[model samples]
Target: MARIRVQNLVKAWGDFRAVDDIDFETNDGEFVALLGPSGCGKSTTLRLIAGLDQATSGQIFIDDRDVTQVAAAKRNLALVFQSYALFPHLSVADNITFGLSVRGVPRAERERRLEKTASLLGVTALLGRKPSQLSGGQQQRVALGRALISEAPVCLLDEPLSNLDAKLRAEMRNEIRTLQQRLGITMVFVTHDQTEAMSMADRVILMKSGKVEQCGTPAELYENPASTFVAGFIGTPPMNLVAAAPKDGRLAVAAAASSDLVLGVRPEHIEFAGEGQEAVVAGSEYFGADTVVACRIGEQKLMVRVPGRPGLGTGAQVRLAWAPSNEHAFDARSGLRKSA
Candidate 1:
């Protein structure tokens, strides 16, 4: 595969910048996900790297070769789009071989590559089926087979599993990640789904308002977010952040003079203690494996995740506490994480 580098990348239209100056690097065979909400510029950045769109002012290097101005067809990168983009009229085999055939690859070579790809993706029998005859997961596999057969060192997927059902999506996530590791191909995935990015990527690049909010391994971003936005955006049930001030040597929602600090804790970290912050249970959400209790401490709200089921119910008084190390401090005014 290839190492990818983006230096001072910027993409603008008129006065609005879709992608502000951002820089990051991906090592050979590394899987990196560009993750953000809609309109956050993740897709634009991917387009820039794939040469589908030109950067306003910056450089892109693949394997240490400058290709900021190179044509997309010359980039030697395979792209799998969100829709799978399979031709409805073409059989699976024909769809997968279209690219090879266009480049005049010999029949035997094309067949060899197709066989290997189909076997790798578990889509050998699907070759005779048309797009309409295959299930969503099967279609996805065919699309992947098509991309893999190209044998491009770099693969770019734009929400490749978004169209699948929840169960299929999970299965595909594991399958794709395993295949990616097995093939040792560098992968750049673009998706707005945090879980998809967090679970499937080796590293995550979180973006916000066209800027890189944070870039780190999944655990790094979750445990040591650089900003309040990152903390709120990276977790399941999310980290609980409440405006607070120090009171009686402990933290409270506020006092006469509110402190600039905010208290941040994960849902799973909060616990019931004999002595701690006082709160009232407002409600609860029950998932199959766990339950989340919504608590109200003063005018602020916090969520607590408890295994199985929690005894707390609406309007129930409770003492909330957590390990001192679990309490993350942040600057309320700047919305940035504070130094420990």
Candidate 2:
């Protein structure tokens, strides 16, 4: 296992800077995820670590060794691609052992490592099968088994689960997390999906415009976002940001004007307050155990995720309230939080 450190990393293509100066480090055996939307420079960062793309400037250190100029094949690191790059004619056993054979490892040692990796991945029985005969999830396990047999101290996964169905993706995520912890290999996963990053990462590196927006554990980014962009980007149904004004000591949301500030609240944070319903119900979506209520306060829209919610029709009067602790205040100019 190895700790991965990326310091002052920058990648640029001509005048277009793909990755700005970004600094992040992961402890040995820590599963850190690089998360961002498309064109946010996550993939570029991964390629830099994998030695596939040269950085414009900066360094990457694995196990305290500076490997900024190391070739991908010589880095002693494993990078699994989304394509599941399995050879067509090779059986699972052959595919897993190919790297070892190419590296000139003895047959006995290769078999031993192959057996261990197969057992770790629960793919021992599938060794005789070809890629065409296996399901997507099974094929993914074979890919993982191949990487594991390499015994690389660091593993980089580039949207490895993107090819699987939703249900299988969820199942495999936990499985991968278990395997990662059990084997104690430091892992860095790259994905645009927030749910994947939130579920699998020990810590998340949130990026935007080739820059580090925020980096923290999933709960930190979700509960105390540093900016309106982070708050809006990190949540499901996202956060409800309204143009707000300070009314006396109470915060007032406007439909007609922006009086005081822009106050943000998550959908799950807003509670339904009844015919004292000061806001209008613009829409409601039923989801068996809970409903997502879309309330309009002035000209702004705020969604509230309420469980076992009472039926409220469109134009139904309702009031919205968020706990003081759940409220996030941001600076209008910088778009950064007033306080963490």
lDDT of 2 by residue, 12-121 (tens): 99999999999999988999989999999998999999999999999999988999999898888998888889988999999999999999999999999999999888
Q: Give the per-residue lDDT of model 1 (tens digit) for 103-151.
A: 9999999999989989988999889999999998999999898888999
Best by TM-score: 1
Q: Clashing residue pairs, candidate 2?
A: 245-260, 255-298, 255-299, 274-277, 277-318, 277-319
The Cα local distance difference test for each model comes to 0.90, 0.88
Off by over 4 Å in 2: 257-260, 274-277
Per model, how many backbone clashes are there? 0, 6
The C-alpha stretches of model 1 lying farther than 4 A from their native spots are 247-252, 255-259
Model 1: pairs clashing at backbone N, Cα or C within 3 Å: none
The C-alpha TM-scores of every prediction are 0.96, 0.95
lDDT of 1 at 59: 97
RMSD of each: 1.7, 1.7
